[model samples]
Target: MGERLIVIEHEAEAGLGCFAGRLEAAGVEAEVVRPYKGEPVPGRAPAGLLVLGGAAAAWDDEGYGWLPATRDLIARAVDEGVPTLGICLGAQLMTMACGGTVERGDAGLEIGLGEIEPLPEAAADPLLSALPSGPVRAIQYHYDAMTTLPEGAVRLATGARYANQAYRLGDRAWAVQFHPEATPEIFASWTGGGDLPPERAGELNAQVEAAGDELRRTWGKFAEAFAAQLTRR
Candidate 1:
């Protein structure tokens, strides 16, 4: 059988939309496992590990019974040199598992479409090296922040509000605070009927709509690069 990318879905709404398609297009099979729906967290890491975003905070292990196991799975993948990608909550889990800290963002919730500034180190990084210079636009929706990165983790991307927007752990493990897998429709499902004011929500919608093409162009390359890395392994 072809190599499989294990996708840990924390929530039903936060499915692997664009990422799944891009990975499949690159000849990688994505096998989704919903731990939230009573699916067991794989004890062993697969060829590739993809942990999607979630509404729960990383420290909410008691609330989300599966978080602790998922975190361990991420740690094992990184330790064993598996190509791993974590988004939002997934990023937090990866960070925490790797001796980093996850805490609430005192700057409040960072929602809506925003630009992430890639650090100088990203110029030669494997996954982020494919991105264009200047601020990379991405969808953001998270209340938690990775306060401290793991030992020797290279910080790749930053934002005006969040300093730790992306980082590379070990060799093949990557964790991003932004949501590259989120499309406009998926983002709408996140912020459409929330407590956000109608005007603010509309503005966010317009911003995402305007930047949709660019997001796909840039993040698509990033996703494909991830898949390419998996294939190389």
Candidate 2:
């Protein structure tokens, strides 16, 4: 069969967005699977897997009927060395699915554009190595944090608010707490339409727009590196 990246979208609002163009530019085809719309999770691993963000907690399998199956798929993908990228809630699921811990952050909500500092270990990491050594600005919108990583997982990046900003499992699997794929429009839609105060939403929207160029520059390379890893495998 031809190569493809299977994207599991948990919500209609949190679709592929900016990541779609980047993956396409890297010559990686994406097949979005909306599990929230009754799409069944795949039984077998694809060439690559991308689990996007969502509103539900990682352990809320009862609330999201497909989460258990999705978690199983993530575990299988990692075990099989499939190139997998899990963002936000996806990362929490990856952590929980593989014997890690996910909990509501005691630091309260970490929402808005923020910086991620790459750990020294990230210098040699396949996906993170391509990123600059300095703090990289990324979109952050999550209430939960990964208190513990999966067994044998390598912590790639860390932040002040949340230490577990990014990690790698096996060789190809990656889980990131921030949203590298989010665009300013998406951020605005999330903030402006949500319970965010009008002034707060406006401020974040401006920050997202201001940091747009840098975010794309850094995350575009990240997406390319991830695709390269999948190609090599």
Candidate 1 residue lDDT tens string, 96-208: 99999999998889998888999999999999999988888899999999999999999999999999999999889999999999988888888866769888888998899
How do the predictions measure up, each by TM-score? 0.97, 0.97
Encode model 2's per-residue lDDT on 1-233: one tens digit a residue. 33599999999889887777878877788888998889999976669999999889999989999999989999999998889999999999999999999999989899899989999989999889988878888999999999989889999999999999999998889999999999888888889666798999999999999988888888888888987876776
lDDT of 1 at 7: 93
Query: What 10-residue stretch in candidate 2 is worst by lDDT?
Result: 224-233
CA lDDT of 131 in candidate 1?
Answer: 92
